[model samples]
Target: MNVKAQYRVGGSGLRENWFIGAGFGAQFFYGDHNRQMYFWDRVVPAYELHAGKWFTSGLGLRLALNGLQNHGVTQNGSHGTGEIYDASKWLEKQEFGYMNVHGDVMFDLMNMIEGYDYQRWHVIPYVGLGMMFTWEVPRSNEISANLGIFNTCYINESFDFTIDVRGSMVNDRFDGEQGGRSDEGMLTLAFGLIYKINYTDWNRPRWEAPPRRGPRRADAAKRLTSELRLSEYDALKKYKDDREVVRQEVAVLVPLPSATVQL
Candidate 1:
């Protein structure tokens, strides 16, 4: 009987290869500004929570809830760098609370180009579109276009260390100011961990087996050394017996006569 082995592929389905993450970083707004400020003065803290699923090794999608704090510089009196008519226009930097809910399409560059494997690193770039809602006092909203890149290092089967650099373009009115360009831009840098849920490996190439062989069967007649027939050998043995027949001699005359006298 021949027994063949099969590959079990039940767990490798649409329900597999999901992931979630959390991250915090700094955000810088390139918005309308006047006068002078230090580099750190225009930056704010940013936070993010995200979940994603990989449809294949090369492609995936993610939804992220990003924001909490955002910084914006507005004119309290006038415009132009260091040319503000009012002295307090430089101090009009508004620290606001906001949230950006966005969905991104991610492409794993190495995995897509080199094929799937347990790689120690992956570089993923993405693009998204979202709405930014600002809160506290007068609540407002703006449509945003997003772009980002992620670098991930392998930690184990279920987790990875990740660093993300994100860039976004929003309506200039979102920051309560109008800039030279029609859209305003923001840049953020974050670090975090990603946990994959029910991750599954992709199918691999199969190997071909060599042909099988067994021991050869043996024949009794083929092992014989001499070429003699059984019937001839038996006839020769009988002839030798017939030719060698001989008579036996006995001495009994003296013994018989003594026994008769004794009786």
Candidate 2:
């Protein structure tokens, strides 16, 4: 974990920069005979809800729940039974309801270079491993290796706009048949919103930063100075009154009046 903060050059905590997000988009599958089908034919609606925390401005961790449905093109009879999509006997669409839960280690590219900035877009690239459950027949469970990029921008203190592009690679048999390529995978693009629970920014770039504790108390207990303070006293009489006289004034009256009467 210490190595993960190489670019952070700042201090942070697990509780500091946490976020949750949800979005909807489309997914495409590639494997087996899926390669023979039109790209659009393999398209299915995708959705995701994820939450994560930034341990540092440059590094983070996330857990995402991605789901609803998956699309594929396979020989109609090649898919499993019980709740699986059953098209005509010819090669056709194989759709199923699925949910993939994944945990990722995220690295912020922009953070590595310029550190955290709320006003600009952050480019985060991540890698993870997950379990994909296809709710069909005898419930097939497969582990997938995931890779993705997230583009996000601050919309407000509490909200952010984000776009994500991701891919998951799994065992060839994940799609029910083991032929074709060595492995199967799917690609996804989702648009979403992320929200911060309390404080909404990273506590990095400047390592001295600390997480928000909470609003300060309105009326804290007043400080008691009885044992904490000391007072100094001086008697006023000791500093004597000093006096100095520059000049003394006296008034003279009748001398000019006798001369004026004679004139």
Candidate 3:
């Protein structure tokens, strides 16, 4: 069985902001062999609420509230006398459950993938591993609250009227077990899309170092020429005093401009 399964389908809300949503989906029994339910099975009708960083990147956790119904067949009275032979008669034990309070920690697995951002409209398939508990109440009791048994056949089988407030009548227990607290600790998983609110700018490129403030090739060449000329002038001036004859020849041949004189 695939450990990864999606349950909650199609989610949408404001991005990078607080969001509240209502979603309905099936809890597949494909996750683990123990969690699967079959036909005529009473599966809970599940819902969830989520709140997280508006549109953040990677691994986010959300709290989920779920409701489940257990409508599976149970052997009545154990294997012995008074043993219920017909499965149809077992309807007396069928119960309706309510889970007004249950919570789970949901893991956003899409965050595990590299560079998976939650800003765009992405169907981020998710799996939830958590616990759920439900209070089982007799279906007959709910019915009797409205319509009491009319026929003599059902008169003896009539639902206890006291259950109208307490829901304590009728033997609607699992596997035909004794009527008492039927609490279960279970693990649940589901796959669904988290439709991130669409945005024009989802990814912003990394900031690049401002293009190096560099001199162009022509500018560099001109700079090199000026430096060489200045160096030659300084060298000539330094040795000219020692060789007065050469100095006079240079002065006679070339008249220095004011710019050169200033240098």
Candidate 4:
């Protein structure tokens, strides 16, 4: 019996290999007017959902939606009396939210060099440009750019855990305050799960028929002729042996003329 091994073939079609992922993380904004760092109020809830396809082992494309809740504190100076500044009297708190819809180009570093391995970890870096739509007192939209790195660890054949770190650049009015050349972008760190929707074995073995060397009909005819010749030779030998045995038996029974007996 001949056994053949199958390998995975990297799928090139649109529907063969695809994945969808969702993640949640803390998002922080850095802007000119609000320079505070590590403020509890500054960190907001952020989430992301994306669908992507890998055209090759090294290259892929993704469309994603990122949502963020943003918070900012207003600076109000003390009265002219200058007696004392009240924390609760003048400090104003502002909160808003925004959504980003973007398309990204993904590059798989591991797959580009070493090749795709479903069992191994992959580090993918991506860059994207899109628009941010803010929902605040004065709703506004602006163009934005994003840079991110995604790390995927395969938990099974169809699922993976991912760690994503991203940086985004948007218009200065994103925080409802315009003070500098550009508004502060956001930094997001998230953890999520990826599910493979369509799994194609890019490594499946492709079987090819070996070349035929001779005509099929001629080979079959030659084989049959050789078998017939062999059978005929065996039959002739058997017949000659049987005839000699019969002759010997007859001579013994009939008692043929001997030298001492008259003719």
Best by TM-score: 2
Which candidate ranks first by lDDT, i.e. highest? 4
Clashing pairs in 3: 6-190, 6-191, 7-190, 7-191, 16-54, 17-54, 42-71, 44-68, 44-69, 74-175
**Model 2 / residue 62 / CA error / Å:** 0.4
Candidate 4: residue 17 lDDT (0-100) = 67
Q: Give stretches of model 1 more than 4 Å off.
A: 1-12, 34-36, 77-91, 204-263
Candidate RMSDs in Å, in order, are 20.6, 16.0, 21.9, 15.5
Q: List TM-scores for all candidates, in order.
A: 0.67, 0.69, 0.36, 0.66
lDDT of 1 at 173: 72
1 or 3, which is superior by TM-score?
A: 1
Candidate 4 residues 118-194, lDDT tens each? Answer: 68899999999999888665687888899999999989879999999999898776655666445677899999999
Point out where model 4 deviates above 4 Å: 1-11, 75-91, 204-263
lDDT of 4 at 62: 91
Compose the digit string of candidate 3's lDDT tens values, residues 89-116: 4522233343422222233333333233
Candidate 1 residue pairs that clash: 35-82
lDDT of each: 0.70, 0.73, 0.33, 0.74
Which scores better on lDDT, 1 or 2?
Answer: 2
